[model samples]
Target: MAYAPQEVVDVVRMAACLSLNLGTPDAQRVTSMVSAGQEANLRGIPVVLDPVGYGATPFRKHLCSQVLRNVRITVIKGNVGEISQLADAGGQVRGVDSMPGQIIPLAAAAAYARALGAVVAITGATDVVTDGRRAFAVDNGHVYLSQITGTGCTASTAIACFLGAEHLSPTLSPASAPAPCPAPATAAPSDPCSSLSPDPDTGTDPSAEPVPDQIVLQPHAIPPATPDTPSTAGPNPSPLGATCVTAPIPSAAASSKPAGDHEPPPYLTAVVAALAYYGACAEEGAE
Candidate 1:
């Protein structure tokens, strides 16, 4: 069904997620896809794109680029050939089918994910999902899946469903820990020398001659303790001993933020979950 640009925007605003497929796109559909994607992005709705038959023709490739450029895609699901081609990693693609033996490489997929800044799922015998930083492999589907058409497209739809549900769920609400309290200030111990205030009686004696700088020696002076003769002195013993005030070391948990809190739900997780669910369903149906 054909939709106007305004109509597409209206649909996207009400939708939880948007899915774009290049299965049968023309110049008009391409414009609609861009318009829908932009509207979805503005509404903060997740978008899943399937670049069907991407490398089959230059026109399809161009349309894919335009759609991707216009939208902040959340996830991309495609066959090995299509994904590899999108990543600029050459692969044999005959018509709409990925050439047999044309396996998607993990390195290429990771590079693509990083370049696109989106979770990428390349479907095959062993489905690979990655968000650049982490990759997951889902090996659960029956051989019958390959026999069926639209399995790749179905996977894209499944991803959109999962993204939509995630969007609606309140689990994703912001749950930030409270800011740490400022440590209490403690009084510093007074220096022993500070106790010897200037003699009050001699305070105004400007006529007093400036005394020569000299070290006063006590009559009962004790020799500096030699390092060889270890003194059984506790920390900072006597008024003359050097004093050190060290702050308490914080606990490990308080010092470092929890790894879970820092990382948002991984996009790769959603992709893997969707693929696994589909694969499980396919396996059950086959049996």
Candidate 2:
């Protein structure tokens, strides 16, 4: 969100996390977004990529691949199909809803978590969370909540806000309001190296013909004229890879960074928020 810093400060700043929810089947576009997000993360922010309607298109499947390969997310929150699609584990999807998967078993989910190196949060009749080695299920939340289009993305970000806070605690506790996360670590060398893979739906070569809905973000490009505005530039959001949008919790150290690139990571805050949300919901009890 570089077009106007203030705008980013207004929209993204208030935001606890950055959610990449692909509305289309553009496999390649998804790839670009994942890379862009990691760039934000390097800056200390946390990113949450929500893959909707996986198994809906060959392009969508490929997009999942590109996303999985690029970002180091704190949490991967989705229904069964979305999570299943992520690990190259096959499953059926109904529009954006999950039908089921061969990996529906708890062991399968744990295996997927190990392979992907992420915490898998599957929201089904019950919700399951695992970092490959550990798993927890959350039975809170209303079914009506799932009807909304961006609810999952929003939920993921809400969790980010908590993690990004100074104590990595949710602001919901008025008595325990926390300060922001530390500023980004821009002094670190440029991270041109990312795990985000190219279009497997298209071809192995970077210059290969792109399949329909297949696109990837380049390693060097400028992002966000502002958070409200969308970026059209392709690839390379920053030549140095120091501008990841996924932010960490804002700490006193954030103030030490130089001007123009000192944005604190919202990611850590979001996670704190997520934990807080669950706590609140648990207090209220299930409907």
Candidate 3:
């Protein structure tokens, strides 16, 4: 599905973060989301699962559970009551929103995360993100933001904006993910740039993954891909898509050059900053 038209996939990948006002997706539709999620993981896009009103009804809870179990969710955002329900707190919920006076509990948040095997983010006057044992409190938001509808979804979407929306590698895992982007993500420990984040002992958000040092280059190296036959490009970049790359050079030349002792070409200085610096120093800018 990700290999489909660029617009569709980009929207689909960012749908988790974007203010996608999708109605309660049915089981079959949610299953498609799961498929898209796994593809997003393989393609290295961030997936955010929102259990909008999980505990409010058996249907919501069951559907959210299925999505959590299957889809690759980078963060799960919900109000206190909603999150509590997912955690099985059985808090009283008036409609989908948490009832007024419902207190957010750290234990419930933690339990929900453990049960779903993913990071949990609960939104209230203050937002709490937890991977069961580890927790982070993110306070960078305007109170007015919540006054509007779809604001929570917007925040989730904001997280994805730093991805393909900005600039980055096509193969690396997402960085600065507010919490764990659980499941189906293809990012690995071998990724040199992978953030060692969500500190288990203390709550510290490894700041958002730094955009790959923009190195001017040609048609970027497509992500590692399996093809019916080896082709030059895999899935094309979607508008809102963010890329997770392996060891990336600051600039394109460094990436293309060999690290061994071989001397760089004279023209190599023309494009590569490292080689250019060396060449200028070696020859004092002589023609």
TM-score per candidate, chains pooled: 0.66, 0.52, 0.49
Best prediction by TM-score = 1
Model 1 weakest 10-residue run by lDDT: 212-221
- Model 2 misplaced regions, further than 4 Å: 1-16, 25-32, 100-103, 146-150, 166-287
What residue pairs are clashing in model 1?
Answer: none
Better of 1 and 3 by TM-score: 1
Per-residue lDDT of 46 in model 2: 52
Candidate 3 lands at a TM-score of 0.49
Best by lDDT: 1
List the global CA lDDT of all models: 0.62, 0.46, 0.43
TM-score of 2: 0.52
Question: Please, what are the lDDT tens digits per residue for candidate 3 over residues 1-287?
Answer: 23233344465545433222123557666666666666666665555556666576777667767766765555566677777666666565555566765654454555455555555656654455555434433332344544555555544444344323322332335574344332112334223212222222233223322212221111122222122323222253111012212122234353332233122211111112211122222223232
lDDT of 1 by residue, 113-166 (tens): 766778888887767666654554565667887777778888888889877765
Query: Candidate 3: where is the Cα deviation over 4 Å?
Result: 1-22, 162-287
